[model samples]
Target: MIRFENVSVTYDGAYEPAVQDIDFTVPEGELTLLVGPSGTGKSTVLGAVSGLVPHFTGGTLRGRVTVAGRDTRTHKPRELADVVGTVGQDPLSHFVTDTVEDELAYGMESLGLAPDVMRRRVEETLDLLGLNELRDRPIATLSGGQQQRVAIGSVLTPHPKVLVLDEPTSALDPAAAEEVLAVLQRLVHDLGTTVLMAEHRLERVVHYADRVVLLPSSGARPVLGTPPEVMAVSPVYPPVVDLGRLAGWSPLPLTIRDARRSAGELRERLADIAPVNGRLPHGDTSPRKDPNPRPEVPAPRRFLRRRTTRTAPDTSTPHPAAAVTALAVHRDRVEALRHVELTVTPGETVALMGRNGAGKSTLLAALVGLVEPTRGSVRVGGAVPHRAAPRDLVQRVGLVPQEPRDLLYADTVAAECAAADRDAGAAEGSCRALVSELLPGVGDDTHPRDLSEGQRLALALAVVLTARPPLLLLDEPTRGLDYAAKARLVSILRALAAEGHAIVLATHDVELAAEIAHRVVVLADGEVVADGPTADVVVASPSFAPQVTKVLAPQRWLTVSQVREALSS
Candidate 1:
């Protein structure tokens, strides 16, 4: 249904083409996954299919892209809207209506569909994506993941033959991601719909793809094959594939079930050894021990203990870097958070995890003073976050919000780093150095807006880390990061923890939490549901467990690094 013939795209900038000689054919009713590292022109390819590459993005297209018998070059996006539905990386930029129901119906209205047909499709999409409860909520008031669902539903309501999605599940929790993927699966299988999706989180969608298109790097020719064939030599792959490679499996596994089936012998080999609790440096052969040890208390009991003991103070106990006691936050008459309790000490790494609207971001907002608590207290470095002075707060805490662009407001990358250094009172080159370490190829002269989502996230993280605040909070830190970039981030955050910085990151990437988080704190419906050691909490939960944990279950291995360490020893 989709064909790219000798395709190449180059923007107005004086540099190499974003993509070159990209030729591929996606059969009708099949799901094709575009996989690559950051800045590899995956988004550009998607744009070309939707007739947005040169038409709207001001780029030069060298070859033809045909979708559903119509050439994209001849038909603009609006003209092709009847057969094609495209959802870009940022969902907030895609909405044209105020409420969820209206957003879902907007596309059909544009298509001039009958009102009754539009209403029926809208209701079906709402139920399919589990957005029925949020149908009346304002698009602006919904969480990032919720907005993403609304964006997807909007496109879906039109019942297009072809769907182009960029990072469709990046903002969703595991269950919600599964729901979205399942919806796509139903479309491809039952309805004969064609899908071309580009995503960084391969762990979530690799198994669902009917075929895989691997883009090695920027301006490189593409490699197309089956999921296993592409993953065999692909630079980027999920943990299960990595684990299969480490254990010398015949064919790399894409799903947890396949990995588990092939892990019988490997499990026997690792049966005598216990996995490490946290990440270990490469080539480190030291004895595996829990880096951040905790008492053997159950999660529920531990939460209750902390709640009951909050009223009494121990003078000898060192002050926590940040603490939230019975915190509650209300937004638009909806309780975003309620009775939430959390504490972070120096050198501790805590991961806040939950569903799409589960109050994780709200709690982070409370910590960084972005949201005022409706009830209870939020103290950072011995001062209430909402009441702390700006200068004092800068030194005490820093936040990298979910939307990385919100923290960036400079014309160039160098200027943004310089501004960050100045605002943090740090050395002139400190922020730039952090950026170089996190994202090496990013040019100093490049505008922050020109960078890819992963690059922008790296820049934002560098800006925050320049301050060297005692406490750091990150929301969805790995949203746009590939495995290599995520590894670099994990190493940097580990160094910061070693330097006595407390870190709290809200994320849906369970693999990231397994790699760096010393403890995992789960929230649901604006309250803490589980709080305990990383292994204990993640292993027990079905929705939040990483691929490694699920594959090596009955054993408490949380990451491939830990499994590698155990096998080596």
Candidate 2:
């Protein structure tokens, strides 16, 4: 059990306290969820519990904090190592070993556990994490998801009573994230270990949480309650929750299975009303009211979206593929993207999804000539990447990287847009208009990276669109976004596809793939394992399936909106 008695934390930096006069208690063996928008002190609370608050982080802590009845102020992280285990947003920051096996054993060795005990725990944890196959693999070779599991396994080997995770699944692909989450669930359900986790992707994990703690950013204090109690009152929720609100169902269903049943009842009761057509007319239910002094924690949402200017293209005609061919790439070692055949006509959105290090980034780089493949050829607009100068590719192919900081460093957003246009020989006036349309919040003089990650991605996208690139390659475009930001980003991507721009969105979000992508290409170990429509690809990989699939139309649905539609229909 972890208890905070009037605990407030203030950092040395200028400004207000990170956490103010907070009082809360997490009972032992309960799965508690800590949720709030970015910079909301969720991580601060975790640090307090882990003995890093005033110790490692050098923060001022008022009042008392105790774990399992032991005062935390007296115990530093190293001192409390036997009681609590913690993981952070980025795994690379905490890794202390060179290989997966060595990584797992490092923590136990710190505790001075006997060799036999350590070996048994190591073997058990590796098997439990489904990482036995990668036991000897170098930590650097593992995907983001795999590395995170190894991190978790390392901590669990010591058998701490409390586990704290800060967005453990944020960087992972949907399938691998689910695998890691399942282990966490098992730990809580089977072992009764206390789990406190803060995450942005609530839709993926909210349904499974035993308790919900919502922290409003305006220092409005937190509200702790059950999942349904919190979600029913949540100002911003996922599509299913949104449906429950708009449809006015009592005891709102957090899962689609329950939503489906309630929806059927509503349909029967409202049979006399205008026959339901999945989507209501121009206006459905009134928008949610946010007159409260503090806004409820809106669901983890996106930063922003970019747009391209041009009368939206009409994608009514599907272009026939000239032919499917193999693209070979050689980079020191042969990372074969075997017979990588893809079929995309104008107007199709194809999503490339896989765990980190699965070659999604490599594939994107290959198409643009940043990396040359020894075996296959990349033909864009019926020409090769090097076939044109960087300027020519700017006019024909657009690429947005995962880290928005990668290409943006200009003094102003307008300058960045103008630079891309000048290189592509596009009209400066046209570029400015396109940038404004794509990023409404940003001004001409705004620093590109100064905006949020979502905004930067949108800005980069706008700059690329300004070039009128026929083929657009976006790598993990939604990497650090929340629910609303991701929704808007996909909306923009969808609109672009509707306008006939050939788009390849490389992402780890299965929900996004289900919602926007016409097709999904699954890459594993640097090779395409499945390529087809979103529905087909989801069917082929059950773990990669989105939550909506398990909820409404267990087999056919991929996105939450689709699940809601099927339920009402």
* Candidate closest to the true structure, highest lDDT: 1
Off by over 4 Å in 2: 7-21, 51-64, 69-76, 256-324, 329-336, 354-359, 386-395, 403-469, 498-500, 524-529, 535-545, 554-569
Number of the predicted model whose TM-score against the real structure is largest = 1
lDDT of 2 by residue, 1-569 (tens): 98889888998762688878677788888888887665568888888999988898886999999998888899888988988999976577779989998989998899999999999999999888778888988887665667778888888999899999887777677666777788888888888889999877776678778998877778877878998888876544666676577668778777767877876654454334221112111112354221111111122123122333444433444432112358655554436365666655665667888766677777787777687756766766665775668876675668888666677778998788778778767666656766666566567888764465567777877777777666788887765566766766766665565446778878877777766676788887677888876667775576666655554443344454543444465
For model 1, how does the per-residue alpha-carbon lDDT over 259-357 read when each residue is reduced to its tens digit?
989999988998877654433322223854653222211122221232221122222346788989999999987999999889887777899999999
How does each model score on TM-score?
A: 0.93, 0.76
CA lDDT for candidate 1: 0.86
Query: Residue 537 of candidate 2: its Cα lDDT?
Result: 76
